[model samples]
Target: MTAASSEAVAGAVSPLGRAGRGPHFRRREKAWGYAFVAPALLLFAVMGVYTIAYGFTLSFARWNGFSPRWIWVGLENYIDLLGGSPVYGPPVRAAALNTLWVMIAVPLLTVAVSFPLAVILNSVTRLRTVLRSVYFIPYVTNGIAIYFAWQYIYEPNGAINGVLGALGLGSLQQPQGFLGNPATALPALIVVMVWTAVPVAMLLYLAGLQAIDPALLEAAKIDGAGWWRTNRSVVWPLLTGTTAIVVLLNLRDALQGFQVFLIATNGGPGDATNVLGLETYRLAFLSELAPTLGLASALGWMLFLVALVIALVNQRMLRRLR
Candidate 1:
């Protein structure tokens, strides 16, 4: 045989040869890959796509959620919701305002606290792991239990009031308790929200700090920059990506989250702690006399759009930083 003929025979016979790359073999490989992914695709189709489509359709219809029939309402739900209808508009608008406050306050406070705390923890040599666990514990703890614990702490006779009395600030005590008072309820909730969010933000900041080169710190020191100045000028700029993530996540949570308000205060004290998410929840699940499912769905979509706009704005601003 010629040299080319021998090589062609070897290539055809080899286990790692053109046969394995043939059309039939490639089709079998693709079939196996699809088989592996089929279950996940099935799950998403049922749980994600179907539910979202159903909810969108429901938003345009009046349904009691149990009735087989749906009355077509067109844009009535959206109008009642956004056009300041006496029945639904006031509470929703107030809740929207409350949600706006949370969206601004939680992210700003979380970043402010977490970044500094992360900086301090990053410098620690002794008990570093333990300290990290301590901070992270709140993030991983049972949510209901944390809310209950904070509820106790906000009680009229709880630790906070006791400390206030001890400090000769008895007149400042809320007779109705922190969560029961209209004036202090939202701020108190904001504190807990910030507390729960801080650890995660701090963890992100800590990871960002560790990824930074040590030489940058040394260079700052050599240039006679103080510790505070170095952090402000050198370290802070490097962690902008981390800050953006932290801020965006917390903003999303603030806009969409309701469990904290639901479990802690139930939007009590004359709607002082009411937020958009909590209002949506109340309309969808809690309102038995009136079926506001359509309205709730409309509100949900509005919230989604608001979050999307704010997130887009945030991304644009962050890009400017870059």
Candidate 2:
């Protein structure tokens, strides 16, 4: 065969030359299909994967976030963080306490408020939609704007204290408006966080309530169960999934409570309200004023690991609930 004839002969036996695909050819096509996802894989690696790896790598370094002074210090940063660096820095113990307090307060307050509201909303007939919207208004409201507005209300002579004075509840001239008082500091943030969370959790419970079969409720009533008994025996069991989801979601958000912490306290009134998230941000970026980048990075990874562990526990609880 000549060159052109030889080429034509190979083409004739090639996959393209075949009329139909066999198993081997289909497997090869599927193998090539995986190549189409390569761009997404590459994008994720660069955007997400690389940044995480680089951040953790920076934790051991003794450099500012910028500049080329990135010298590795072996486990020094971790040692100082774990073992306590009395002379050079504040120990991480205080931040950990603040975080624990916020975490507990947020979830407890959220569940306490939202669950009752959800139950009442479920029981009532008229204006349910309006009530839900009213409750949910804060969730859609801008947190930054709310904080600034609330910040004023929290000021010494602001409207809240004014209300207290008008009601003869004692003037807040001693100047404690949920923001400054050491007692109220963490609880105030927890209250705002809980207020924002309720609408969402109430909505979840409402969904669960709606999902309940009306026929079952009626059957329970006919079988001599009162409304309260019917709800406990029939409705409550059905709502377990949504309850689990709401509790876990609320817990997760509360544990990660940064926005409220940052806005409400700025970790203030003498570090009385410092959650781990705020501490991490302050150390890493805020400390850029003095620039303790390595310390900040170490703090950040610590917070990340804590959050990851909480998330895992949340997921495990959710699974176990099923």
Candidate 3:
């Protein structure tokens, strides 16, 4: 047989070449798939997995973040953060408690405000979309700008104090600003966090409201269920899943996010607003003495474990509710 006939014979006999998918074709297809995904995989491996692994490893070592020598301290950093060292223990414990306070307060307040707001928005027959946009605008807007605006509003003579003065309630005003006072700093930040978080939670609740069966609502009305009763009995239970999601997202953000705290208070007013994430950042980079990357990593890992346990417990509780 000639070369072409021999080639045809080989193609017909080979399993891969039987359907016109030769070895070269299969290899090329795989190569193209890898080519499309290689960048993303490489990025995730390096930025996500590798960094987490390295950070975990660094947690057990003692390093100042600039030294080449990493002294292996085993659990010294963890013990110090958990209250072994006087210098680091008190602040770390306080920061952890503050973080827990935020995590609890923000989510509960966000749910309380957002669910009602969503119900009100959903009830509106006119300008519904506009109202939603108005509420959601804060979530989409520049966070730094919003924080600054809120800072001004919380200022000694800014909008809030001005309003209080106009209403003849001047005694309610903070002369050093709400954020400037240790008594009010964390609560003020919680208010802003809830304000920013409300829109998203409301949006999610709106979706849940729409997903609710209209027949159930009609039945509740037929049974003489008023607005409050209807919402409490018929609507709230139905939105448990949505509530769980909103709670979890806000909880995670409150636990991990510190930008608002950084900009608004910088964990100041005598560490009243200091949280775990901010404490970690401060330890790693903004320490008055040497930057303790190892202790920061240990604290971060502890925070992660705390978040995990809380999330799991939350999930179970919410699931039971559902």
TM-scores of all candidate predictions against the true structure: 0.92, 0.81, 0.92
lDDT order of candidates, top first: 3, 1, 2
Q: What is candidate 2's lDDT per residue for 195-290, written digit by digit as tens? A: 778889888878888887889988998999997798778887777777767766776675555887787778888888887777767777776344
Query: Rank by TM-score, descending?
Result: 1, 3, 2
Q: Number of backbone collisions per candidate, in order? A: 0, 0, 0
lDDT by residue (tens digit), candidate 1, 1-322: 9999997888799965777678988898899999999999999999999999999988998887888888899999999998558989889889989999999999999999999999999999999999999999999999899999999999999989989999999998987899999989999999999999999999999999999999999999999999899999999999998898899999999999999899999999889999999999998989874778988898898888988997898889788888
Compared with the true structure, all predictions reach lDDT values of 0.92, 0.76, 0.93
Mind giving the per-residue lDDT tens digits that candidate 3 earns over 36-61? Answer: 99999999999999999999999999
Instruction: Judge candidate 2 at residue 18 and give its lDDT.
Output: 46
Off by over 4 Å in 2: 1-39, 87-91, 171-176, 219-234, 288-291
TM-score head-to-head 2 vs 3, winner? 3
Clashing pairs in 3: none
Question: How many collisions between residues are there in candidate 3?
Answer: 0
How high a TM-score does candidate 3 get?
0.92
